[model samples]
Target: MASDPLFERLWNGSAPMEEWTAAVSDGAITAVADGIITVHTTYFCGSVTAIRTMEGLVLIDTAKPDTAQRTLEVIRSWDDSPIHTVIFTHGHIDHTSGIAVIDAEADARGVPRPRIVAHRNVRRRMERYVASHGFNSIVQGQQFNKPGYVYPIGQRQPDEVYDETLSLTIGGERLELFHGRGETDDASFVWLPERRVLASGDFVIWVFPNAGNPRKVQRYAAEWAVALRHMEQLRPAILIPGHGPVVFGEARALQMLRDGAEALEHLVRETLALMNRGATLDAVLHAVKVPAEYLAKPYLLAKYDDPEFLVRNIYHFYAGWFDGDPAHLKPARTAEIATELARLAGGAEKLAERAAILSEQGASRLAVQLAELAGAAAPDAPRIQAIRASVLQKAIDGESSLMGKAFLSVYQRQAQERAG
Candidate 1:
């Protein structure tokens, strides 16, 4: 069960560092609203919302592949009613990988297969996932702190696909699905009119809106803001987010939608303004900032994503890969550049030494960069590997965002393994 004190701490933006540290552990399933059950987790991945209707139960997401069976057990414990529909909020593995369990369970019970629902672009997203399966496996492993995780490529094809809006009368209860491009191109949010319950997939995750994932594909920040604003007007009494605890009350839910939308809007608008004024992407990243008031909100914590990343995403959205810097437009290969820097700095050993000094001085950011250059210059140097490992671990320790920490630790672990 979700703890009341934990919710209270999250609600007040006072959750301690210890609580944030424990966010990776699996959470319990519990009811957030009448007839609405949600599984909240640290990050947005694997969280799901279940809505009970007169005809049957409607599942919002299927959770991750590892957690899918557990999620099904929890749902079965609550209601033995067959799942009438399974609506995927997006094509991300965490949201879609659990469908196999649902499929098998339905077969065991001799029930008809539930109608899988999703946006029209979901198929395309899955196709992309298949095409880049290996690449995604490597990158996502680092991003999610699962070093050897292989992203499951199989997805239960949606029987019902909609371009924009789809209305369904499930068991005589009207449910609306709206297509919104936020974290991913194929994202949707569910709206139950009579129940006044809104299931916002990734559009309104508890942490900073992931409009800017550095390693992922393009994220639509402007369109994401517009979608949030649209949902805000509906005045949902209970907001079940893709991640985080369920939000109750009209006012609180509205504020969440409005504020989350505004944060993205502010980033997009500010970045565009700077670009219009001929500022470079690097300049815009440092210049734009979310309002302090919004930053103070518990729901707006930058646990997964941060403002600078969003700024960079907006930059990439409007401008292409170039950051308006001639030097970066056609830069040398990273390894080559690192080799050159090492040569200029009196060899890789000097770079490694400098990085160790920097780490001791608490200059983790600079230390990691120097360590990377050293590692690139001398990939098999035991001394350089040790410095890189120590420096990167320091950088990881200093990072607050889970996304940043995960990526940083990837190199840290690699360096340690190499040294050993």
Candidate 2:
């Protein structure tokens, strides 16, 4: 992990440096609220939340498959209480893959397996994951800058599925689960009314809510805002987010939730207005600017899903796949377009030379675009491949968002292979 310092930079963009250092220093299990302990992971994976109930432990979301053992150990250290229940905030791989670890632990202890609970749509999402396992693996590899990662396909089917809301009395403590469409259709937020604690799945991740993941399925931007607004009204005194640090006071929690919600609301409204005016998706993307105040908030950085992508998502939701450009509606093949551009630019060599010059001048995006054109025009050109790789590396270094860095790194690695 130390070899890739950019991961830390991108993940901890808005959070305090010392706080991040402290939280990640050995995966300490800290009490966010009374009887509620959280195991915050280092990267983008969801944090594991364990609530100490009278009967046993009630976990809200588990760590990724790779980090489950360590996270489980951290939870066990806090209390040896057998896990009585596990609630999946959503069916995202990182949050659900650890179920096997917990189930195994329960079996070894001679106790009944923990009852799993989630939104009804979780099974549908898991089925989709099963169907597109290979595609998901590839897309996540590009998204996480870890091409070698093997995403586990196995998941524990939820024992109990709820449609809208379900209040579960676990170990004599009440946990209110509300289904909300946010990052996923299977999203749920847990509210402990007695403790004034809320476990917001990916809905309240410190980063700008991931309502515009380019490769992922549909995200609920407007509905996500609505969910946040609802959570804000609940006024959780202690807010445990799916990722990043937990919020302490009700005021701070409301502020964070409201800010995130309003940001999405503003973006959605602005995008719809542009769409109503018959503006192109590209134009809408450029037109809808996130409010300066929201962008300036420490909890709402553009490190993950930026506002431009959110605008595009809104456009896609309302306007469909067509970007309103007649030429793009039935676009020519990329290679053919590149070949034409290369011909007009004199030759592939000239294009490669120009790309290299642009790369040297720090025009990384344009350099990469030109290099791609050159590579498409002449697939076997080593010079073009090298130029593309170099520019992509530069772009990766300059990128502040993890998504952008991942794409640039993957593209750069591919370019290097081609160059070789």
Candidate 3:
């Protein structure tokens, strides 16, 4: 379905933006007309930006190690600016691991290692990566499909750390850093006061905010909004994001940031209000809505992250896991429910037939629920195969968003496996 192009594209390798040109060239770097420099370090993983001043070349974030070599080559091609400082927006692997390449370049040229700076919390986050490598590998496998790829544990820790705010002058350029929590606990954004440019790492990914990754560590929705508001105050004319294309102009960038923040805040506030009133988790999830205004925004659409997940994240943030219902405290197993439902409906065959009827009548949500129950009840039944196909096709026809597309693909795979 159109709503879930990312999932479909991943499975089929036909994503619309897969070949879209990077705002920055591959294996090359360039300085913008505003004097801010940028490099598209990796296609979808990370980027590096720099600004030249009398003090030195101040870099914002680095690409992944695998991508860093090419990124450095690009940077060197653009300017011979001496690397005197590095500012890490966060401790995410893609943004920090590439420092080795930069270090090697400086050392080879007989220049001193650049001073690394980041938010104080970055140190703890890096330590957590080392402490939980196995857990992170497993989670990354699920999210990225790369199993057993051990992310490097030895991080290039920051030499300079700040708590709330820090200001510096790099090569005569004024740069200000502010701490704001978002996808990560130690997220920070850089504001260029004179050039009116902002290097927003991961905070504004051009697409939707990745605030509700189901498999990752806890994300900060409340803090994400706070960060956006802080950036809005800066009124930067040029916006260089962590991923995706760079946005030019102040008004458009601010509008995008404001809309995104408002969308997340609305979901968080509404979900929390319902939970505070003792509503069940399901009730709160269904009740929270992205305001009508943001639904049409191209950049805020549910392309990368779904809104339902965001609502669930908010619920977990405020109310914890219990749904305030005793029935779910130690609930019946899913298999138990499926077996009972199948028996009540006169076996899996009858349930499959009912699912087919419901699907034909455009009751896709109910049809899928019934089909799942029937499939689990009769794993090898021919009727189960039919029900699976019918339910998935219905979903593919009706669903929207990347999440829905992924679910449809998964169901189709299950149907094929059962048939075989």
Candidate 4:
């Protein structure tokens, strides 16, 4: 273990909930089983897990940029062996960018660089990331509270790409690799049969499974559950999650994976059932729910992704973009609709007043809806914009998920600007 107090508490399974949160967001290195250590690089993306074999060292994820550099320094101080293999859990920049630093280190020492491995789709994802760099930059910036964050260009392509599964024996330690679609289509998880440790990439993040990201591409919710099930069958004694602190024991690891998988499965089942019954998107969004107990688990909190958002992704995958509403098929512009609605309500101020009343009643959803309409109708009205800002601030305060909170903050900033 890292020998830090927080890390010690986590290893003992005696840490409070808030401590778990801190352990992940901040960087640290901890060893689980012998020769297997996980470096929590950056919670915004994922962590890096390194397995030391008799032949050399193998890494699951390199982390990214500055954090990766810091982690690499710590790793070099402890392990001097050449990195023989670098396994990328996924194609995300955070998981792959550390290759640059690793390669640089190898160059400095005049040693062979590690072989980079990933699923074939990881290459395609890297290509897509390069092609859509601008778009990704904007969304990532908004999600992380960086207004103009630019997605790094030219991510490294994996040296080896597998289609289904691959197994390798490094110094008698058997490492099994499998491809399972989850947060990203190219996701892969590592299983060390000998050590009984599972390096579950983003498939098992500490928070809610990011089965659905409102602003991102497709995520496989049902398949994600299947992936977790596969991991549960392995019966790993230690779990190195994509972002969180290492799960120390087998029972705790299995329970956490099951909780995440079951939560995802329940969401998909409920959502698909509603869609099959010809329910509109809005109707299904409000109707579908994961059991309260699933959400109550410490590992399954909606800290990054919400269950309701996953329902939307299910609808998008099974049903197309159409929401089954006739009016939405060719609706008028939002501004046009808002103008007419405000006129009918007497004025934008009237709508804003009603929004304020609803906000005071703790009806944040309805309050924000009305406030947006009011703003659309009269963008220059400072008093109306102030009410809109208040409604948005309330929504921001109530959000549990980091993604939801960051997005709401963007809108709240704009509303505050207009208010002035």
Candidate 5:
């Protein structure tokens, strides 16, 4: 794990400062060699890349606004070259909010505002953001700890939007932009012909592709696979992703891209088949699986997004969330179920005792459910305290998703308070 500092950071987050510092120093960002340039802007969920052409700097995605200011500061530290163009790979907040910061910097310096370019869908995406700001805030609350989301005000729309492909010359080098639907409908990838470098927006995230985020907007797994195949044919020498460290070799990059696409395709096809056969959503979800060979790939590991979530996403795509179970069509509320479960278990203490046993036996799923009931039924019981602790400890020991880990943290805190 310590050997590959980037993987270590992505996986267990256990690398020493010196190792990570060395990895970052090894040109993770702001790489300048052979008069060609690349910059990796680190932001949450996404990153930005900048390339130096003979004409001026061509920036790919500005990152979050605050992060963009810091990114620009870093770029200035290395070279005083003016940013001639800014390409928005997608209209997601993390990718587009930094436009204002870049605009401010260029404006203050009396440099013309860099040309902002994106796919034609970018304007629609921005419009959706403006229209659904409240919905976004509510959905985002489940993930973010802040009381409210910081909605970007006066977001800059793309100055140039294209449907198929657009070619631009920067510093006498030809950079090609291609539209594709992947993590978002508005995704675009930049191909640097001279450098043989590909800046894949969120189209090729290094982590398990987040095609099935349970909480966010629609993701295009089928289209994402298609895009990966398209990029595979290009055979990029250096693959700078929307997140995580860049891949250095063409063969390795192609293999990762191909494997990821194939994995998603398998799931999409299998899920569709089961749905076509009138299988229940649960049956379809349980049936979809990523081949062991593909899962073995280091880049395709389920570090961030779980495959099961993507399976559910596919089910939603086909059948819009009615699970065919008549009872569940308008199911009893959670509190009602908890009350009944509490009554059946003979109050919270018995339920807590059962949960503790389940936790001890490694049945964490059942344990968590029982613990929740116990906590609701007997909020002040010592058994509730014990159940919470046991459930939380199991969660901490397991390899769960990010949201699972966060929920465990919340449970652990609540348990400690009860114990006190």
Candidate 6:
């Protein structure tokens, strides 16, 4: 019941953009390795890897909260074996929130609840989530364009947490989990030494590593590269990435890991080089670039994250938040500054007009900034609000990364409502 060829096409770099993005969230269960099945979940979420062991099944990732039931159904359709354990690749809500549903399902089946596994920091992250539920809900709403959506905070926590490595034998198959800091500080990647299969959490996603997610907390660009390169050394014959299609064959799998690592390593190295030379964050952001060679491979596409964001992330961990600009260190209020600029520029209408012209000329990067200033200067101006909404949509249309587009959509919707 799976078009396994889709995975093959992705590995070979022949899958068209249309077909590729569609399969990104397709819940189709495909047997990628001998006994391992990969079931992708919704967009912006990780994939569910169901590994059938001798005694029972070992599931790596339960997917986001909304996709939990569907992921469970697919796994059950493939194998009725009781889930012996559920290993979370990380504590990201998109990957860990489904634990509650999974645990309830086990209880309903009259089976022992599977042990939920993760890194020790995962528990810490959950604690932070509990303490900052309101903040997270607002962030998630802006991120997913769910204006009034509330983030589910009652999800179950991991029962088994490891600091470094955890080895488990389920159904006679030994699965090795190695901890690494990637998209999040608490991250784990599974390795099947016998099968040469690697379940790399978000470390080897088939897109630019999300080392620079703008909305999230601290991320490790250097550590993320180290993690991917470490997995490459294992020479995994099959790779089930955290968010994209599975990669079969040793060369294909290694290529994905290597390419992703190389890009992040380049960003980290370049950002550090500039920072060491006393360059500003803005300067380093524009100077560092992803070698064009990686673009040839579809797996390294910047669909989920941007290289510029990764550069900024490198600057974040190495250098302090100061952008090396005296003006930015103690900037005046944004609205006040916008109002002043509008006064100097003749009015908010002129700023909106320039922004519209810039957007039409494909200067979305500049246009969006101007539009924002216009909106701040004239928050109740219908004409300014309309122009700001259009400019925001233009930026969203031109954006190639999902994270950037999602945040832009949130603002655009608000602008539209004000304009109406």
Question: TM-score of each candidate?
Answer: 0.92, 0.92, 0.83, 0.94, 0.85, 0.93
- C-alpha lDDT of candidate 1 relative to the true structure: 0.85
Taking all chains together, the TM-score of candidate 6 against the true structure is 0.93
Error of 3 at 226 (Å): 1.7
Judged by whole-model lDDT over C-alpha atoms, candidate 3 comes out at 0.77
Following a full C-alpha superposition, what root-mean-square deviation does model 3 have from the true structure?
Answer: 5.7
Give the top-scoring candidate (TM-score): 4
98-165 in candidate 5: lDDT tens per residue? 78988888888998988899999999988887888887765555455444565664688999999989
Q: For model 4, where is the 10-residue window of minimal lDDT?
A: 8-17
Residue-pair clashes per prediction, in order, are 0, 0, 10, 0, 2, 2
Could you report the Cα RMSD, in angstroms, for every candidate shown? 2.7, 4.2, 5.7, 2.3, 4.0, 2.3
* Model 4, total clashes: 0
Judging by lDDT against the true structure, name the best candidate: 4
lDDT of 1 by residue, 1-420 (tens): 344777678788778534742753455665766777876444545568777889899899998877788777777777789899999999988899889999998898899988999999999999998999999999988898887788888777899899999999887778899998899989999999888889999888787898888899999999999999999999998888887667788988999999999888889999999999999987898799988888778888887787788899999999989999898988889899989999899999999999999998998878888999999999998878998998998888888788888888888888988888
Superior by TM-score: candidate 4 or candidate 6 = 4
Query: How do the residues 1-420 of candidate 4 rate in per-residue lDDT, one tens digit apiece?
Result: 344676555444466546665655545667677777777645665678777888889989998776888878767767878999999988888889889999998899999888998999998998898889899999999998998799886866888899999998876678899999999999999998877889999898777898878999999999999999999999998888897777777888899888888888888998888888889999999999889888776667788888888999999999988999989999899999999999999999999999999999999999999999999999999999999999999988998988899988888899899989
Regarding lDDT, does 3 or 6 come out ahead? Answer: 6
Output the worst ten-in-a-row residue range by lDDT, candidate 2: 1-10
Candidate lDDT (C-alpha), each: 0.85, 0.84, 0.77, 0.86, 0.76, 0.85
Off by over 4 Å in 3: 1-19, 22-30, 33-35, 41-43, 145-152, 349-362, 375-400, 403-419
* Residue 316 CA displacement from its true place in model 5, Å: 0.6
Order of candidate numbers by TM-score, starting with the best = 4, 6, 2, 1, 5, 3
Model 2, 153-244: lDDT tens digits are 76888999999999999778899999999789999999999989988999988778888888888888999999999999998988888887
After superposing candidate 4 on the true structure, give the runs of residues whose Cα lies further than 4 Å from its correct spot.
Answer: 1-27
Candidate 6 lDDT over residue span 1-420, tens digit each? 244676667666788545755765546776777788888754456888888887788889888877888888888888988888889898887788777777888898999988888899988988888899898888888776778888877667889889989898877898899999988989999999998989999887777777888888989989998998999999998888887777778877787888888888888888888899999988888899989888667878888778888888888898778899888999999999999999999999999999999999999989999999999999999989999999999999999888899989988988999999
